[model samples]
Target: MPKQKGNLWTTMWISYLETCLNNYLYSGIWFQQFQKIIIPHSQSSLMTKRLVAYFLINKVLEETIRGDYCKNKNIQEQADPTLIPKTIITLNQVEASKFSYIVGWMLFKLIKRDYLMNSHPKFSVICILLRSLCTEKVEYDVLETKLQTTIIISRSEFVQFMYRLESLVIELFEKHNELGSNILRYVENSFLTNLHLNQTFIQILKSSNGENNSELENEDCKFIYERCVLIYMKSRQKTWRSVNNYIPKKGTASL
Candidate 1:
């Protein structure tokens, strides 16, 4: 890794970012700065350096929102339980935008861990929203189901967002079900690790699977059907009607 030719703060910000993200420390000094930090020049970029600092802090809390409780004891002691990680990240609005990718990537990496995936909603929503906003086109797999890609926010929090995610999901799912379902279904399945709690979502899925046939229009629906089948098979003994009946002979569904 080549050294970055920058002042104290610029170097400090880059070092702290690398430390927090656990990535290569000194590689791609030019491109990483351009892509990740939005820093272009090296001479007395104090404003840019401070922005980087803000980005790193927000990225840390945002990516590991739920885990922050266990990880940042000082932050935990200082914060109110009701305050979500999303709120904290957006508090410094300007800096947060600059570090969006870092925050998003952190959340992505965290949700891949099952224990972390099942841990808390704070982290879950961060993952879901980030993916939804950032990843426009991607493939769906068991990894999506296993990971905590969606927040599965409580009804109470849902009303307060000043914007409803369900409406957003419906709109996005309607337009881009493949990507939407890829993100939404993960939220549906893993948001509440306890399947019993998400009875409403399960029913919505059950109804979709119960009636739909091989002529599926939305890719999200297909992904959701596949995920529901797996979740049902894993947690409950019964098989979903969507899998056993609707799926064609070419495909197979199992736990």
Candidate 2:
């Protein structure tokens, strides 16, 4: 087995992208330019290439946020304990904005495209990226029937963000499109890996299997219900309910 196949391929991919963009890789703005170029070109390119762009963006985010953590032992030693990866995040405000802008746009597109009916590995990684934003350590707090671990993000931030995410699931599930098994696998693994600390999420995953109905709507509802439970778990009051009472309101939510 060759040891360097992955890294060597990545090196070549970066070189390939640099040539196409006619620009050397810089830090923040380079991702913006990459996204801009891809949007129009994507319609005519293979879907697999568009998915590769997701992985590329995620890798770029890791590089910008972790800085030299992988290469420098000193940075790893100095990382914040509260951070799961235990590395310094973002080189500066400019770097942080770049991360946010790209990630937020991807979520918006995923909502629009329904991932073109395919699961993306980087979609789960996107959830992990949001976890990086919490500045404080989590604690065990009791809510109603059981003790709960506060999420990696703060109560206010987590609730607000998940509420918006719930809306995304609602929008997508409402489409009644037949979701591919790959997408379901990614969604399940995302909750199991990144959100296993929350017992409710685990329960939702377990319950989904006992479901007998094979209808597409029922399957979609499983994930939609999971998001709703997640929002409930993150709520400060430990319960959540909302009505769409929109009269003059129509806009998108951003991270």
Q: Per-prediction TM-score, please?
A: 0.18, 0.21
lDDT score, candidate 1, position 154: 23
Clashing pairs in 2: none
Those runs of model 2 whose alpha carbons end farther than 4 Å from true positions after fitting are 1-83, 87-90, 116-192, 196-255
What are the clash counts of all predictions, listed in order? 1, 0
Q: Compute the lDDT of residue 63 as modeled in candidate 1.
A: 74
lDDT (10s digit) by residue, model 2, range 60-122: 757884444354433223322221222222236784444344334333333333443226333
Give the number of the best model, judged by lDDT: 2
Candidate 1, position 78, lDDT: 35
Q: After superposition, how far is residue 227 of candidate 1 from its true place, in Å?
A: 8.2
Model 2 global lDDT (CA atoms, 0 to 1): 0.37
